[model samples]
Structures are given as structure tokens and as C-alpha cells.
Target: MKRRHFIAAAIAAASLSGAYPALAETDQVRVGYIADFWGASATAVATEQGLWEKHGLDADTKVFTNGPLQIQALGTNSLDFGYIGPGALWLPASDKARVVAISSVGNSDRILAREGVTSLADLKGKKVAVPEGTSGDMLLGLALEAAGMSRDDLEIVTADPATVVSAFASGQVDGAAIWYPFVDVIRKANPGIVELAKNADFPQNQFPAAFVTNPATVTDRPELVGKFIAVMKEAGDWRHANPAETIKITADFLGVDAAVLEQEATMGTSFTAEDLAAKSKDGTINSWLDGMAAIYVKQGKLEKALPAADYYTADLFVK
Candidate 1:
């Protein structure tokens, strides 16, 4: 499918002229998400099942290559609503956007080592490739700390996800910290590769994926935002009930092998609207954002630590 940065004028013209009778009463929302196995699943499910229209939204979905770029577009008002993983949570913390809901929570990041490196300490003094500002980097930091080591202990090569994969594949780095399906790709290339640690192994790392929007978008279009969250919740319910069908849809949407996704170890946890409402009231969502902010502060990416209330709220989710 062709991805667009802006909604086409023709679409607006058609909606005004009633060319699309089915969409005449619906609110148009420009949705953006990372193009990965899990990132766009809720959007894809809603699209395929006509849930967006049913919920009074005309979703113009856009695919992004990563969380940072997606959040950048969101910050500049190119996207009205979108997904942002832990990697880009710092952007929202800086007041670029607001996280509205928890999209998923699980182990989406991994630290994979070459055959001979069997433990976290084994990677000490070795070369490690990682995307500098990603959930993978968060996992690497946490894992290293758990092992009583730090970035200085390893020759950390900062690279994008694709480059990290390439470096690991060519044996340019002893280990790589990345997310799937790239992790699966590396394992396919070298079956003996070992997993040093994953976000799942750490009880503290919930790896909460977020659904976000510009603060103004939420303030101006409150009901629209509520409908969007409802659609995602409904889609998440369907995915939980129909794992096989969900896998097929996700594979086709991402152009990934169905078999690989089937074997994915860190399939995220889905929540209901009521579940989110309870979590929100209890400050669970805010606490998650606070944790993300702490990671940024530790990395020195953020100064004068911001509270989760500054950048996140459960009002939309509650509504």
C-alpha cells in the first residue's frame, strides 16, 4: 500500500461532496505506526474488520520505518494519532506529543550474541551493535547493569536497526541488541546464535508500547480520540480470541513470514477498555511513563526529569 505523509486534498473534497457516502459522517484521523510485526496489528485489524468506520472514524493509516521517525511526524502535526514504543517515549517526555493509551506490554527487545558468547558477562570488552535510542538500547542498558557492567565495558557501535543486523550478520560485532523480526532473521542466518537477555527476562521492563497523539489533537477532538482507542481495544480483543487469524493478518500486513511470527516469543499483552480504566485510575499508565522517563534521565538524554502527568494522561482512555 502507498504511504502518505499528508492526507490528500482529494479525500477532503470527496468527503465534503459526499462522494464517499459511507464516510460522510465519520471523522478523518491520520494514524501512523512503525512498520513492524506488532506495531500496526491493531490498525490492520481495525482496517480489515471495518471497525474504524463502525466506531465513527475514517482512519488514513500511514506506515513509519521506526518509532523516532513516526513520533517526529506526530510532533510536527503530520499525524493525528500513532504508536510510539519505549524508544521514542523520550520525545513525548520532551512535550512533543502525548501518550493516550497503552497499546501493548511485553518483551519486544532482545540482546543476541554470537555462538561463543553465552552470557551477559561474556559480552564484556566485546563489540556490540545497537540502535542508540531504541527499546533495544534500553534492554541492553538494563541487562548490562544487571550484570554489573556498563556501556564502557563494551565497544558499543551505534547504528540503525538495519545496520545493527548487518553488522551482526557479517560478524562485525560480537553481539547485537535489536527487536524482531530482525532477531528472527539473524537467527535464521546463524542457527547457533544465542540470546543473552530480553526485556521479558527483566521483571522491571514492561516494554509498554503507547498510542499517542499531539496534545492539541486530544484537546480539540476528544470524542474522536475516544473512538480511536475503542477501535484499538476491540481489535486487541479479536487478536486475543483469534491468534491464528491475527498472525495471518499481521504477516500479510508486514510482509513477514507467517512461520516466523508464529514462533515470536514476545507477543504483547492486550488490555480491555475497562482494564485500562482501572489501570489509569490507579496510576499504572502514568507509572509506566515515569519508568520510561527514568531510563532517559539515566542515559542523559533528558534533563530536569519530567513527571508522567506532564506528558501522559488516562482521560482519553477513561472516556
Candidate 2:
């Protein structure tokens, strides 16, 4: 071939290569989580390790102190996905919002009581701080019922987990229901003063703290959702292998101590798609939710059974 013809052929080949399809750029997926907890730690790992990008998702993570605000953001379309206690989904779902939980992220929050409180019965008439309407509150209700008491038996105070330590220290509350790290703080400060409720005592152990998304988002962006789950599972694997590093990264993100993150990380287990699928089908997840709803109904926090099974989908974990 002539030189000009050869050059033209090369140019054509280059143009074709440039036009070849590449990975689709995923739409921004905003994920909400309360800081320093397992969910937040997972989000941080996914972001830091580029797992989401590797799975073709551009994840934008947002931190919230409570589920109500996170679910509100989901309803308004400001957030595409979030992590919250499975029971918290009921209030939003009741209001015509749809959320499908993709996986179980954490479990069984501890009820940390101040000094001299030996057991659940010791909490009677004491001030207990919990994030109202959250899994912590639901678990607290269950513990109270198990002890033949009720929220009426104590002074219930609503506060964020971050403030629970100071609240307890200042005598603002005699006890608090909190996830790890914060619970760790209370344990460290008060030593034998804090008592933890074991997972076996309440259905809170299997409670689904999940990766949730609005119905419209799930339907409209199924690929994104799939990718998000894939990345989350990847992050979970990384977290399990690199617990110390994961703790440090999470601590940096939450502006807390690595020791605190380490303590929180130890409090729960992470799941993969396979684990999630088995739990969903075995009715374990549903039963846990049902038990929580029962407590809420008895407490008058929920007027009726809210169809807990509809809020989660095992198919999301199938792929």
C-alpha cells in the first residue's frame, strides 16, 4: 500500500479503538449511614478501596445520626441508598415510601447501664437514652418486656449515639442503648458499671441493618443497585481480612479513636450475598422483623403488623 493509504488505515483503526464501548459510567449513588458504625465503616472501605468504582458505581456516601433523617432523604430522592435497622423501614414504608433491604450489616445493640445496675430489672425508674423509633429503642422495648417491665418503667430520653456517653457521665441518663464504639466508651469509662444484654435474650441479634434503596431507584437503576451490593460485599470481605486497617480508616472518617472502631467492629458480623440469600429464605430475617414489630405493637409504637417481609428482597442477593 502507498504511505498515505497506510497512514489513513492506521488513523481509521485508532478512531475505531477510541469509539469502542467502555464501561458505562454509573450515575451517582448517594449512600447514607450513621458515622463510625459498621455501616459507615463499610461505606468508608468501599470508597477508600475503590470497590464501588471497580464495580462500575460512583458512590457518594452521606452520614446521618438517625434513620428518620436518612429515610427522609431517600423519600426526597436526595439519597439513593442507606443503612438502617430493618425495623426503622416500617415508618417510611407506611407513608408510601418503598425500601428493599439487600443485606444484613450488623446486629444486637447492647443496653449499657451505669454502675450498680446488675440486670434489666435494675433499669426500672432509671433514665435510659436511646434514639427513639430506632432498632436500639425496639431492642430496649424487647429487653424491658423480657424483664416484665416497660418503657413506662424508666425515663426514656432520646439522644444521638455520639452524645450517649456524656449523657451518662453527666447523669442526664442512667443508661443508654447504643451500638459499638459508643458502648465501648461507656464500658471503658464505667468498667463494671455497664452491663450488656446478650444477643440470645432478644430477637435483636438477627435484626437486619441493611443496605436499603427506594423502590423507584431500585426499579429504575437495577444495575446500579446490583453493582452497589457487589461492591458492598467486596468491602465486607476486605473488612474481615483487614480488621485493624478497616478500624483505622473508619476511625479517621468518624474522627474517633481506632480503639473505638475496633470495639465496634468486633460487635457484629458482615455478610455476603450467599449469606443474605440463605437468611432471607429461611424466614430468619422475617421472623426477626416480626418479633421486633410485636414489641413495637405492644409498646404502642406500632399500631399493627406492618408486613415486614415486603421490605426486603432476597433476589437482590441472587446475582
Candidate 3:
């Protein structure tokens, strides 16, 4: 009854707010994502452009500050879909959410520091900020490892991405390893900060950003899943064919400067429907997920080794 009320309220609120317009009656869907981040720009694009409605889904997005929170919401059946870094899925080791497709890919990571801080070695005993359960948290550990240090050497503070910039600016944290457009906030304030490491530097993680859905949705409503994929493909097509428009839409949505967005939002190799189908069939994406799950274990985020197959299934992607 509570879930039904929530969905009904979402539908009424979404319709009343004039956020989107759809053709007719359909199933209401709740999508989750981190606020002001363009890693899932396709979802943003599709939501804004009314593509979900065109495909017969009355979609309303729930904003989470990080991926793990959204993943937790999935366990409670609060969200039908989520756009998040693949790491959060591995942390819980629960078979609640399933990755249906790669929505979009963008690399936005840098170990940002002020003028005086030279390297990770210099950050020993110094405070650094990162949002937990996102790429920043994962890469911060990796960056420290590369610098021959660990989180023990530095005061790793968990701050919301929204406040991390203020924390750095006020000397609360010596530095931060966070994703853009938040990185742009740091850069705009302190132009002298440099990247201690980048996403390209960590070749092992694959840095996959994906669209995950409630498992029951896939089993009970196969055609709806196919329609959702159609929306993803349409959004992807629009992104490639309209780069300038995409940047504008994304920047407007994120409330960041288009110039800053252009610098950090590099859409790496994206997945087409056919590519997702083929890769799922060949166990290629699964290989990356399995490796990522192992990484979570090594990072001590998970208690035991959990297979990627348990974390997510490619059945929806393949079918």
C-alpha cells in the first residue's frame, strides 16, 4: 500500500509539475540516480525529452546523492531502475537489482588537490574528502595504493559530493578524489589543483556505468524491458548525433558551465543494443563485473568474494 501510494504521488506530482507529458495511461516507473552528475546523462536526456513516455512508461526519477543509497533503495523495491557506478551493486552482494544495459559512459575522476599539496605521499595524516560507494571512493583507494600509501595514512573523510568542494576550499579536507562536474567546482575555486591520477590510469576496473533494474520487472514484464532498452538506444543515438545539444542539456540539468562539462564529460566507447546483446552472450561484460566484484572484496567493502553473476544478470541485456 505504501509503495502504491508513493508511485501514485510520484505520478500526480510529475504530471502536476509539468516536468513531462506522455500520451496515455501506462505503468509508472521510478528511476534513481545521483543528483547533478552526468555519468547517466542518457537517463537525464531521455527523461527530459519525454522519451520514456513515448515508449509507454510514465517515468519519474528519484535523486540520490550516491549509488549505494540507490542500490539499497532497490532492495526495498522503491526504485524500478537506477543509473550508478557498478561498484555499489557489488557491495551489498544481494540479488535485488539487475543491469539491463549500459546507459552511457563518461570518465570523471581526478585526485584534486590545492596548490601546496603535491602528491598522495604529501597527504599523509592530511584529510581528504570523498563520497562513499561511488567511483571516487573506489579510485581514492587505488590512487593511494599507486602512491604506496593507503587510507590509513590519510584521514579519509566521507562527505557528500555537494559539500566536498566547500570542505576543500575551507581547508577541512586537504584534497578530494571525486568525479565531475563536482571536480569542476573544485577546479573553479582552486585553479592550481592537479590530477594525481585519472580514470585512464586504472585500467583494471573498466569503470563501467550502467542501467540497473528491479529483477521482477524483467521476469514479469519482458516487453516493458524491451521498451526501456529502446529508450536507451534512442537517447544514445541522440547523444552521438547531437553532441552540442547533449552538452547543453546535460550542463543545464547539472547547473554547470558547458565549458567545464565538455572538459570532464568524455563519453568513452558506448554500447549499442546489438553490442550489449553480443557482449552479454559472450560473457564479456560479465568478466568486467566479476573483476569489479573481486576489487570490492580486496578493498574490504565486501566480506567475501561474490560472483558478478550474483550481483547482476545479463539475461535482460541478452533477451
Candidate 4:
């Protein structure tokens, strides 16, 4: 049934003019995205190269700082589509939206500790700043659990990632968990800061960035959503083929040096059809989300464990 549906949808999208037509046929799609770093690779590649427009979509890209804000916008029906980390869906608002595609999985996040705080264990009993319910927040949680502690073991202060950096600078917190290029921001401002852990440093913190849509959007316009994923997959393919160019474009978008973005490029894994297929075949993503849901429920942030299938879908990206 899923295969037949995918074939039908793919044929419909391609039959318009040609396979992946470079034509615009719709009004601006208000797309919420992080301008900083989370999903920057694809956004920079896709937007700059007119991938969306090529697929008959005029994406009105709106800059958001984190997954919580983007996911919140989806609940209110403010965004047609957008990117979010797994942590964004940990909140109750997750029920309002569903994941349409998985874009990337990598180590783009890190834990920044004040000079004297050198290890995750040292973060105990200290005020730790985190953007609660975001991927970084989950990373901090997993790291704590790995260390035989919980969020309760530390003074867990909640704020967005940008403000978490500010709070860290103002001496309001002893340690902070954030991802690039904000991690770059802190390292530049205070060379003395040390990384206690990065996403790659922990096995439990494998992060994923996905495109989510309002459930209404998917049901009302599955074809359009399919086009969006097709273009996104194109962008991902292009980034891999033209890594240098995409890196430069991403650097300009984030106002960081190509060198910094270059370093970041090596930090995480980008999703291709093959990667997504392998993970899906092994039920990797769903299993991971099941564990993450359990963690969020244990923390009492969610009312119950939402099914992994409810939060993410690969139907659009299957082809």
C-alpha cells in the first residue's frame, strides 16, 4: 500500500512538466528554519540554489532559533513546513504536528563548561543552562544519565540556546549545552571555555533534524509535501557533491568563517536516501525515538509516550 502510494505521488509530482521540473507554481510557503546552525546545511544549499522554486515552491524562509519555536509555529498553523530536532517534539505540542522527513543526523551540538569545570561529572550541583525540550536539552539529559545523575542532580536552568550562551557569559550558569555556530560564538569570546562533551562523544545523544508539518498540511496537500522532500533530497545530494560550495554558502548564511563551517561539516552525518533506507530497514530511528520518549516521560514533560510513528514519517521521502 505504501509503495503504491509513493509511486502514485511521485508520478503526479513528475508528470507536471518533467522529472523534477525547475518551475514555480505556488505562492510563498512560510518555512520556519534555524538561521544559526541546526539544519543550516540543507537550508543553505536548498535555498541558495533555488531547489524549492525548482520544485514549484516559493519558500518564504523565516528564521527561528530552535526547534521549540519552530514546532510551536507548526501547532498554530503559522508555518507550512520547517526543521526541528527530536527534542522539539518531546513537548505536548508534538501532538499537533508530524515529521515528514528526516534530513540529517550528526554531532552538531556540544557541552560548554566554564574554565574550572572540565568534565560532565564536574557539572554536578552547579547551575546548568539548557534550552529545555530541545535536542541540546536532551543531550544534556543523556549525558547526565550516563554520569549516574539526573536533571535534578544539577540546578537545571531553562532558556533558549542564544540566551543560554548569554547566561553563561554573565556568570549565571556554571555550564551550558549548545550547538554550533553558537558553540563557535562561545569559543571565540572566551578561549578559556572547555568542551565537556559533544554529540559524537556520547552514544545515546545521536541527534536528528527533521522537517515537520501540521497534520492538516500533510492531509490537505500531500503532493506539495512530497515536492518539498524531493527538493530537500536534491539539496542533500548537492551538498554532498559540492561540499566546498555548500560550506561557503552555509558560512555566509550563519556569518561564520568558511573554516569554522568546514570544521563543523565533519562533525555530523547527513542523511541520504541510502542512509535513511538502512536506518528504516533496521527500525533504527523508531527505536531511538522510543527510548527518547521513555526518557521524556520519565522526566514528566510529556503526558504519555507518543508512538515513534506518530512523530515521524518517511512516506514522502521513500522514493
Give the 10-residue window scoring lowest on summed lDDT in candidate 1: 5-14
Query: What lDDT does each candidate get?
Result: 0.75, 0.66, 0.69, 0.70
Candidate 4 C-alpha error for residue 36, in Å: 3.1
Per-residue CA lDDT of candidate 3, range 173-263, in tens?
Answer: 8889788666766766677887787777877667777777777777887777776776776776666667677778766664545675665
Task: Assess candidate 3 and give its TM-score to the true structure.
Answer: 0.84
Error of 4 at 282 (Å): 5.4
Better of 2 and 4 by TM-score: 4
Q: Which residue pairs in candidate 4 collide?
A: none
Q: What are the TM-scores, per candidate, against the unseen true structure? A: 0.86, 0.81, 0.84, 0.84
Those runs of model 4 whose alpha carbons end farther than 4 Å from true positions after fitting are 1-24, 91-94
> Poorest 10 consecutive residues of model 3 by lDDT?
1-10
Model 2 earns a TM-score of 0.81
Worst lDDT 10-window in candidate 4: 1-10
**Global fold similarity of model 4 (TM-score):** 0.84
Q: Model 4 over residues 1-319: C-alpha lDDT tens digits?
A: 0111111121222221123555457656877776544366687777788787788888777767677788778778788888887666575233767777777776777778989776788887899888777777877877776678877778888876667767776678888887765676667656789887767766754566778888887788888788787777777777767777888887676555677566657766776656775776577877766766777776566778778777666555674
lDDT of each residue in 1-319, candidate 1, tens digit only = 5763111211122121111223235888899876565677777777887888877898888876567777778768788888877877887888878888887786768899989777988888889988777788888888887888888999999886666776777778999888876676677666899998887687774668888888887788777777787777777777666767877887676555567566552467777656877988899888888888887888777895668887776766766
Question: Among these predicted structures, which one has the highest TM-score?
Answer: 1
lDDT-best of 1 and 4: 1
Candidate 4 residue 292 C-alpha distance from true site, Å:
3.1
Model 1 TM: 0.86
